[model samples]
Target: MRKLLASVFVVAMMIGCPAAHAVQPDEVMEDAAKEARARDLSRELRCMVCQNQSIDDSDAPLARDLRLLVRERIAGGDSDSQVIDFLVARYGEFVLLKPRFTLHTLLLWLLPPLALIGGGLALWFYSRRRSKAGSATDPSHLTEEEEVRLERLLAAETSDKQA
Candidate 1:
């Protein structure tokens, strides 16, 4: 039983491990530090073909090309930002997994909070109006005619009870 459990656990781990990076062996940089930097930048870049997956995770041809480009730029001694700027210039800002909060993307950042505040204000106003409508039947709010009719009803009830 123990052997079976051990075997099952091993299989589960093998299956659960993330798919190997799509980077080919030949594309690996000679410098380990540069290679690590390239890998990090690749994770930040969106694969043009995969759309949703980062270049590091994507198996698509375009993702592989982008990975190579990043390594080449790193090997050429470009700073991380320079490599990123090169890609952005070539592919536009959509290539970034996380967009910069610039003027163009300002509305994207602000929209959720604005929507939440607007919804809360609407709910507050609606509840306030609803409570006001509900409280219209309160005795203190009754018209003079309504108050007189209520008094008459009470008097009639008392007289009937006495008799």
Candidate 2:
């Protein structure tokens, strides 16, 4: 039984580790430094065809093309920043996996915290309102008129029982 469990665990791990790279072997640079730079840039770039995935992790044709483009730029002796700038100029800021902070992105950064504070305030108000409503219906807080009516009913019941 232990052997079977071990085999199943190994198979599960194998299945979980799917092949992640889309870069073809031919696109690799001869220089180790250039290849490393290309790989780093690929991880920073968004795959246009697979919007949420980095180009390095995507299997789409566009991702492969972008990977090759990055390698070509590295081989042509462009500095890392220059290669990134060139790609950004061509693809716009959306191609970056993490966009830079700017006036236009201020709302994007502020919205989450604002929403959390607003939700917290709403919950506080709702709980306070619920507490007030609950107190109004509690037996211990009955009005004087209701207490007199209750007492009369109890007295009538006691006299009927005696008779």
Candidate 3:
């Protein structure tokens, strides 16, 4: 029984360890240096169909095509930067997993911090307003007429109890 359980565990591990790599054997370049460059480029390129995944990790047909294109560019003697630029020009900045820092992307980077500071300011002002409103209505700060009315009500209750 123990051996059967051990066998099942080993099989499960082996099956789980082979994560789906979209690169087929045929897609790999003959030159080791070019293959390495292609792989690196693949990791930087976004899988357009699977927006969140890199081309290297995506199983989408478009991702496979992108992977092949990277290898083709590498084989054609394009520098890594050149290959990236080529793809960016063809597909726009969205094809890059990490877009270049530019004027257009400045807002993308700044908006989160700006939003956080704005939210904090709003919260601070809201809390201040709430505290001021609470203090203004406090029983200790009631008008003379309100205080006299409360005292009479209390006195009437006490006299009724005594009677």
Candidate 4:
């Protein structure tokens, strides 16, 4: 029942908010299938100008050029891989929204998990050390002279309060 309600809410949100695609009418291909392919490819290619936004979602001039270039490649009967390869050749791996897993990209993929594990280990060690060290000012570790002084201070305060 909870899953059903959550699914309904998700459906409602999707219906209520349509995606804001930036594909200009003039850039759309005459062939519906080619247009769909181009759109899909555009979504997978990042806009170099926007850095983080896909070409399909960016209004930048460079993004529009990339969209057109994608349509041209698709129209020329280039396979998706061929088109991606062409772009990667022209613009380096930064052109793809999701980069391929290769030795060159190993650090990009491994850094996040490595940082997380490193942070967790560091925190665990810190907490363990703190626990073992105990509190610097813990009264239980006081010497005989210190304990005698503490008792004397407490008795003096008690007597002053009563008076």
Candidate 5:
């Protein structure tokens, strides 16, 4: 079973031919500095369409285009901050993987804990009331005469059983 699993993994690894690996002559980075800058910026940028993935790891066409744009901007002498600022301006703060702490975002972050605590309190109160209700004595209180009658009936049943 281990050998079979290993062979399957090796086969899967060898199957897909990645386009990035077969780069054209023109696509090659002419300068080491620009290449480093591109790598640095790509890591910082999140893929807008694929909200979970970094722009560097995403293989979507839009991610590829954004990567190309980052490379072009870096090659044109834009600083890392400038490239990031440009993207933020174009896509709004949603492009960032980490949402900034603001009033609206703060509420979003706090909602779950607030709801959990509120729900727990409500449940506690409800169950406590229910338990109290369950344990309550009968609404109609038995008079002393009724209580004496009940005891007599119980005693009669026991005496009859021993006969």
Candidate 6:
């Protein structure tokens, strides 16, 4: 019974061991050149589901379908620009990682600089207001009564310390 249990444990451990990964035998490439072109195009296309990753690097089902569609288009002899246009037509400009510059996208491109200029103007206006309001005190600006009182207080403090 002990030997049988040990064999069973050994067999289970062997079954659980990691094995080398291999692509499935059923998958076949209709055209290797098209596959390469698709891969290159997919590298430039962002995965909408995973914004930071390109479609080529994403494992999401949508990314896989997009990759396959790109391959099919390339195999159909579509130029790079034509493939991109088709995708844009189907999925909007948001599908692109770097959207093209246009009147519609002008605000998206200009907002950062516009915000910076506005912020700089605000800071300048605020600083100008602060300076004009005389917030910084000068020694000459002290009133005669205040100077006298300060001198008397200092004298009293010094005498007390000496005592």
lDDT (0-100) at residue 134 of candidate 3?
99
Candidate 6 stretches greater than 4 Å from native = 1-40, 132-136
Q: CA lDDT of 123 in candidate 5?
A: 100
The candidate 1 region of ten consecutive residues with least summed lDDT is 15-24
lDDT tens digits, residue span 78-153, model 4: 9999999999999999999999999999999999999999999999999988976886568898999999999999
Error of 6 at 110 (Å): 1.6
Off by over 4 Å in 4: 1-21, 30-33, 135-137, 140-149
For residues 1-163, write the lDDT of model 2, one tens digit per residue: 9999999999888766433436768888888988988989998999999889888888888988899989888888899889889998999989999876788888887898999999999999999999999999997998999999989999999999999
How does candidate 6 score on lDDT? 0.77
True-vs-predicted CA distance for residue 66, candidate 4, Å: 1.3
Comparing 1 with 4 on TM-score, the higher-scoring candidate is 4
Tens-digit lDDT string for candidate 6 (1-163): 9999999999888766432111112222466776667767887788888877778767676877787778678878899999999999999988888888899999988998999999999999999988777754755678999889989999999999999
Candidate 2 local accuracy as lDDT?
Answer: 0.88
lDDT of 3 by residue, 87-150 (tens): 9999999999988889999998889899999999999999999999999989999899999999
lDDT-better candidate, 1 vs 6: 1
Structure candidate 2, residue pairs in collision: none
Measured on C-alpha atoms, candidate 1 has an lDDT of 0.91
lDDT on C-alpha atoms for all candidate structures: 0.91, 0.88, 0.90, 0.91, 0.76, 0.77
Model 6 Cα RMSD, 1 decimal: 9.3
lDDT of 1 by residue, 1-163 (tens): 9999999999898866544647778988888999999999999999998899899988888898999999989989999999999999999999999988999999988999999999999999999999898898678998999999999999999999999
Error of 4 at 156 (Å): 3.5
